[model samples]
Target: MKKKTRTRLLVITACLLLFGLFLRGNPDEIIPFGLVIGGAALIIYGVKNRRQGGQPTVLPIMTKEKEAHYLESGMTEKEIEFFRETMNQTKKQILQLQENINQNAKLKAIDLRHDTLRASKALFKELVKDPQKLHFANHFLYTHLPNMVDLTDKFIEINGHEIKTKETYEKIEESSQIIDQMAALIAKDYQQFVADDLEDLDVELSIAKQSLKRDNSL
Candidate 1:
């Protein structure tokens, strides 16, 4: 068990034990017996679970350092936790999609699909670095990315049939075209998310060039 889990269990056990003891002092109270029994059972179960290498029934524990880092980025603890979970889920989906694309010979042959997947992965990496910008990626995270993965999965499945009819071929072509469109949309999503940064860079570059030209005129 994790230290956090052990600590939580210990605290709960202590509270129960204290309440049980307090009730025990009141000889007329029958609840004290049950409280004590329950507390004891809880401790025993926790210990046994640990001994058996049970998984911790908690979210990933944030270290003080990581919490401080995210705090500096203007994210509350709740937001940080949410971002972490969301990013982890998104990463898994992206990886699975990449694996699917790689395994399918037809998908590998499509240059547009490769480019699209690369763009999506790049955007995901940027989000991982700065989760504060997660708000800007709501559509990408909740809709585009998921839909892209699902469509690609279905496309691959359809393409995998040993026997193919003309209709099947047509459907596969249509799916491929739709996936290409989704890839373009995903690329646009990435550009829009970073549009501010790109604009800022452009402004800075223009300012530098004007300053240099003025200095040369002197």
Candidate 2:
């Protein structure tokens, strides 16, 4: 057990002692040594399991330095699994870290675009129904469109530049449409981006797995 684990055990032991004392006047039954040890073991076992903590989600996608940062940032097992699924085509667990960052940037852009588009669409609807809403729309678009456009533009650049895959075009195109649909609520294209990002995250992780040709692949 680690120092922390020992400390926790000590704390639990103290609580048990206090409880046992509190019941001093009750049943004069003596506490068995075996029972005491058994209870302590259970406490230690729980502490160990709690300390075991799951492997990181973004660990496979980051550089050593970046991975340290990721762990420090407290990634959950589910998040790491999701991250692995996104950059499935990676060459190695660690190598996937870099790809994860890129995919993350892309996903973040999509999210931002989604929020912006959703707001824009809402404002657009309001503007159409209540002319007074134009001021709000103009305020939002003028204040934020440049940033949104810049992010989408970067997403386009990254996807268009293509790290790999013939389907890259389709992915980027779908993302663009998703962004538009969010802003316009036209034909329900936004779902595709969410679905595709999840799939791609898995796809990328699958690609990184080692075949019979090499070891240490994911």
Candidate 3:
């Protein structure tokens, strides 16, 4: 048996034994049958739990680099690893895009792109908890992120050379506008990314709490 399972069985056995002793000490005092039944039921439930290999519901999610941040966040080890990997990939793309934005000559475009990237980073954090829902964000991850980075990089290279013609400036401005719009659209998708995860988490937690209550009553 697992150590946790053994511990639970020991606790249940102890409780049941104490109850039996209490009844024995007061055999003629008309003890409540309900107490005896509850104790027996708890013992049976513990045995069943052991047989089924039930585990506890408390899961903590935190990366080692976070330095005790989210100490109380409940996530399993797999969930933590998934969240960390997703965040790393996202930060890489954001850094590349930010570099391009910083190199842009237009101050307004640079500021807008910077703000959009920051918002996207925040959204990434909010949406990472639900790995299942991550598939819904594939377009942003696989297409928009790379596309924005590529467009901005090319625009930076082209704009750094000269400002001789109005048409060249227009092209640079257009590229900035396109990248800015894509980032905004990507940010909008963040709401969709987290929606399903939040709903599922609510349902899971409700079921877990109800199951705990039922077990306790038994």
Compared with the true structure, the alpha-carbon lDDT of candidate 1 equals 0.80
lDDT of 1 by residue, 1-218 (tens): 77668667876776676677676686455466656666776787689777778854355667888778788899986898788888877888889778877877666665354476777788898887787889899988999889888988999899989999999999999998887777778888888888998999999999999999999999
The ten-residue window of minimal lDDT in model 1 covers: 105-114
Better of 1 and 3 by lDDT: 1
Best by TM-score: 1
Lowest lDDT 10-residue stretch of candidate 2? 89-98
Deviation in Å, model 2, residue 129 alpha carbon: 1.1
lDDT of 3: 0.67
Candidate-wise lDDT, in order = 0.80, 0.48, 0.67
Q: Indicate which candidate wins on lDDT.
A: 1
Candidate 1 shows a clash count of: 0
What candidate 3 gets wrong by more than 4 Å, as runs, is 1-87, 105-114, 195-218
TM-score of 2: 0.24
lDDT of 3 by residue, 37-131 (tens): 55666787778777677754332454564524333365555665665676677778788877776665463355465566766676676655444
Error of 2 at 212 (Å): 72
Clashes within 3 Å, all models in order: 0, 19, 1
Worst 10 residues of 3 by lDDT: 63-72
Ranking by lDDT: 1, 3, 2
